[model samples]
Target: MTARRPTAIDIVEVGPRDGLQNDSRHLSTEAKVEMIAKLAGAGLRRIEAASFVNPKRVPQMADAEAVLARVVDLPGVSVSGLVLNGRGFERALAAGLREISFVAVATDTMAARNQGTTARGLVETWAGIAKRAEAEGLFRSVTIAVAFGCPFEGEVPLARVIEIARALAESGADEISLADTIGVATPLAVEERFAALSEAVPGLPMRAHFHNTRNTGYANADAALRSGVTVLDASLGGLGGCPFAPGATGNIATEDLVSMLERDRVATGVSLELLRDATLWLEGEMGRRLPAHGAHVSPWPRVLAA
Candidate 1:
């Protein structure tokens, strides 16, 4: 029997935050706002538009408040912020963002290197953030970074991921996201872990965040869909990486992912042509040819808007 696939999906654009955090260049606040506006114009409804981390740690996101102030009014679009600690979460709350994504790593070494905490400590942090967001009636999501594998700690056990997810689910996360931080996951692994998470934490929604660092990100996305995950994350122009993860590459490009999904009759509600156009604009602004192939190629004929 054929497996059921989601006819439609939500692709949360992480371009403004995760996409730029690792870049050598820091885009002006105006440019960042323009990027978010252009992404929303292309039908990206859910966008991770800013990160509220220390400027010294991730300077590219230093203008988090300024960027949010400008883009929060985009009609019919949801603007969110990423936070790694209580202070960042508090800043997001003060900024009045309705949604926030909190990240927790899978292992101690990655946690220390990424944020100078233990994985368990991050989980504790998430519980509190979730509680505060709930009290504030804000949408809260927790991403399990390096769920597939960690550069510092070769392989992260599946049990550990399930444990972390269980804690988040119990702690009031509106959504649970799994990140392939360095992109070491295969399709099989993606399917297995998502299935296991579903079984362990029944009924909670799942989101997938894949990096194209190993060229397996798209395949992992397919597996996540087949495993009943409808929400996925991508960076515009395929331009993002975790600064904590060495040798990691950009994310699965939004245009490329949209093109692939549209071909399979999966509705992402994104305009492929416009996405391609956006990719070109981004490349020109950043002054580099992104790893994504969508801008270099033509969208499938049938998927174009009239």
Candidate 2:
């Protein structure tokens, strides 16, 4: 008997935030607003629109509040922002964002490099953030970066990843995301790790975030879906990388992921043609070709002429 695939999946569009944060060129607040509006028009319901980070650190996201102010009224879209600390979380709340994603690195070395804190320290901070989010009636998601492998520390043990995830869960995180910050995971490894995570936190909503540095991102995404992950994080035009994780590439393309899921008979509630158009616009704005496969190929003709 053939395995049954999920009838539907949620693709969280992280292009406006994750995709643009690492780019050298800074997009204006207006440009950010336009990009997000186009993405929502393409039927993307969940979008990570901005990050409340220090401007000196990530200038691309310096206008998080402005971007959110412009696109918060877009119909049928749930906008979320990334927050790293209490200050960032407060910024997101002030911007009227309903959902927030908090990131914590799996290894102490990465945590120090990314956020200037140790893993334990970040977890402690996250506990407080979680309490505040709950008090304010905000949704919170905890993303464990470098869950598969860390650039500074080479390979991260499964035990360590699970331990961190468990800690975050105990801290009142409503959702969990495992991120392959350096994109070094194999299909089997993704399956095994997600399976382990599922066993550790049964029934918890889990997400998978991957980079395509080594070209295993799509495979890992497939493994993640098969392992019962309900949400997959992707970027438009495959436009992002980690500023800290050297050699890391953009995420799995949103258009490509949606195409694959649609072809596999899974529902993603996204329009491929609209996604393609958005990618083309982004390519033109960036003045270069993007890495997304859907951006390069023409859509197949629905009806062939005899």
Candidate 3:
């Protein structure tokens, strides 16, 4: 058998938004700005800086607009924000953000819990949002969440995800993403589902957002890459969880994913040293420890002793 060649990996840092939103500790705008700047200095080109959502639900993202303004001008870094509704999308556009991502779940139960609407209504709403963003020339992409599996409603059918992807693509979304929102996916499930998605939507740029709750995040990420997924969403120091999905851990750690990619010779355009520093600074700002394997486990001494 022939060896499979390594593929280019695009690590999209979602720590600023996803990681911080679920955190109990509220971070100041300066802290958020510093964290993003450090990540940028670490060679991360794509970072989801913040989300424009109701402050009542996610107080951590209350200063999203300010954060975006502070970090968008940095060189070689593209900042993106997550918008849940038309109002949120408008806020992102008004903030001069060129990249935005919207999400809808695959099951009605999960959708209602997450978005306060049925899955069908959520899809319709996102389609309209995609059209509006396309007309305004501000929307960059849209993502359908819980595409792989749902917590409220376990075992989301592959057909549902494919249907949502097709609808999003048809609605003029430039890119689509599948999220393991509850972290219930195994490697086999990841491969099968992603393969089905590839066959269903050929050439449509897709991203995978996996959580490390079940310890299958890295394995699932490797599966996604092999299945032709290029964009991978991760959080620095594993900083996020689904507020709606109880017991859900953080997203795949940015440092851990980057380490895997670099060791495998995959091009991620990220610096481990800079990422480690970002994680440490984030932990300091949060006044607690975050879950990052590479940061928690050091290799400096081993390499030096050798």
Rank by TM-score (best first): 2, 1, 3
User: How many times do residue backbones clash in model 3?
Assistant: 1
- Quote the lDDT for 120 in model 3: 81
lDDT at position 50, candidate 3? 92
Pitting candidate 2 against candidate 3, the one with the higher lDDT is: 2
Per-residue lDDT of model 1, residues 1-306, tens digit only: 646779999999998888998888778998898899899999999999988888887788888899999988788888899889999999998888988899988999999987999999998998888888999999888899999998889999999999999987889888898899888899999988999999988988899999998889898888899998989999999998767566678888999889889889899999988888888989989998988898897545746666
Off by over 4 Å in 2: 1-3, 245-248
Q: Which of the two candidates, 1 or 3, achieves a greater lDDT against the reference?
A: 1
| Model 2: per-residue Cα lDDT over 16-133, one tens digit each | 9999998876777888898998889988989999988899988888888888999887888889999899999989888888889999889999888878999988899999999999
Query: How many residue pairs clash in each candidate at the backbone level?
Result: 0, 0, 1
Residue-wise C-alpha lDDT for candidate 3, range 1-306, written one tens digit per residue:
423525676788999988988888888999899989888898888899998889887889889988888988888888889988889988988888778888877889977876789888878888788887888886467677887777677788889888877777777776778899878888788788878887878988778899988889999898888777889999999998887667767999989898888878788988898888888888888888887778878754356643
State the C-alpha lDDT per candidate: 0.89, 0.89, 0.84
Span of ten consecutive residues with least summed lDDT in model 1: 297-306
